[model samples]
Target: MAIKEGLRPGGRSARVQDAIHSAVRALLQEQERSTVTVPQIAARAGVTPSTIYRRWGDLAALLADVALARMRPDSEPAETGSLRSDIRAWAEQYLDEMSSEPGRNMMRDVQASATPGYCVAIIGAQLQTILDRHPHEAAPSVDRLINLVVAPVVFRILFSAAALEVDELHRLIDIALRLD
Candidate 1:
């Protein structure tokens, strides 16, 4: 589905795009990001390599679009009245998704893309859309709560050597909310 103001293609173009995206997603599941190639994607999609090149210009663009599509549907933020509950629910949802197999695979691909700028552009749009939906609170405490839900976990994902446990995450959320 398209976003509120995003453009959506139609007709054969749409079909081809759908096919290519499905194929790329399937390929990511089967292989690592370093091993995916246009020829492989074409074979998986049951289309010629030329078709992919013509439609997407390159594999990175195609993969980025697929990732954006995968990430878009779950972008809705939780709306519990308390900032702690809301941010915990929202961050946990994001963390759960990112820790899943598909999410990890897509992240690997995004990290490896030669044209990461394009991938960033699409993913950033999705993040912005989520932020827009939530509409940040003015209270400093609420801002910290939101930041706790988002920033620290993201930092862990990028820098920590150990795997994250949900309990630890919940604790982080608790600390963020100042729930004692």
Candidate 2:
């Protein structure tokens, strides 16, 4: 999503969002997810229910916002020299993180959110960064990586009972890199 020019972290708006997101996270830890209410989150955040309604629309959106925050890359992808190695390493790491129980829960929350495209954008940005590292190689575009790799990994994480394997990720990476 296009962040408003002035709404970055440390601003009042960002502070409020952080507080609300923190509140939801804390509440989920303390009680059942289904039992957490808007008023409860608002009370915990020191904001009114209207404030959350105006900003996030509903509980699902708020949870999704938190999930998105959790999904953001904390560091750059591994610098493994070649495009194929870099992508395989990154995909394997991505699968490992997203296949865990908490990660699966977060993915499900993001799926239920109205701004699901943000998830794609987050993944795309990471791939773009990797692609940028190999300027001379005929690597796949970020869009192709998203379509041929990340999307399927995310799908298996959220839906399939079996965890996505690193070898499978390697195969997907090969397919993505081989594409024109």
Candidate 3:
């Protein structure tokens, strides 16, 4: 599948995208997100700045794409036959992704850009899919579950300096599920 919308669907195009994403991730590792520029990324990726601009529109968009790719789950969330285990697994994975430096930077770029709700929407959809498979006893709405699971993690990550420990994540998951 095409990594993002509007890209051509074939061999050379996929190669170019892979190169660009790799370049962006490498740059993010070495430098601050603010310091990285389209020109810099283009040079590193062996493509022109116009290519980056045409494909992603701007640096923030490019950053969001790169970050989203890194954050995308390798597989669907596993079904553990219980809503609690399923939510715990999903929350743990989400927290782990957000805890990384690049993940945090990507989130910062995403939040600063016009599409702040992008990640929440994506995660909400994923949670909804999981919820669909195993009907909840209380049948909580996806929004409520999203707020319960995602809101606190995001709040603490964005607002606080400390990293979220495993126990805290589990506690949050427990609290969210308890309402069900």
Candidate 3 residue-wise lDDT, 61-152, digit = tens: 78877777765667788788878788888888888778676567767767765665667778877888778878645446778777776787
**Reference-based lDDT, residue 171, model 2:** 83
Q: Which pairs clash (backbone N, Cα, C closer than 3 Å) in model 2? A: none
Model 2 off-target regions past 4 Å? 1-9
| Residue ranges of candidate 3 with Cα displaced over 4 Å | 1-7, 178-180
Per-candidate count of clashing residue pairs (backbone under 3 Å): 0, 0, 0
TM-score of 3: 0.82
Between candidates 1 and 3, the lDDT winner: 3
Per-residue lDDT, model 3, residue 121, is: 72
Lowest lDDT block of 10, candidate 1? 1-10
| lDDT per residue (tens digit) for residues 43-157 in model 2 | 9999999999888788888888788889898999999988888888888888888898778878888888767468778888888888899999997778888888888888888
Q: Can you write out model 1's per-residue Cα lDDT over 1-180, one digit (the tens) per residue?
A: 211234456766677777888888787778887789999989887899988877667777677667767765553565666554555566677777777667665565556455435534543454444445545642224355446655565556656664467778888776754534
Q: Quote the positional error of residue 154 for candidate 2 in Å.
A: 1.5
Reference-based TM-score of each model = 0.64, 0.87, 0.82
Model 1 clash pairs are: none
Task: State the lDDT at 10 in candidate 1.
Answer: 72
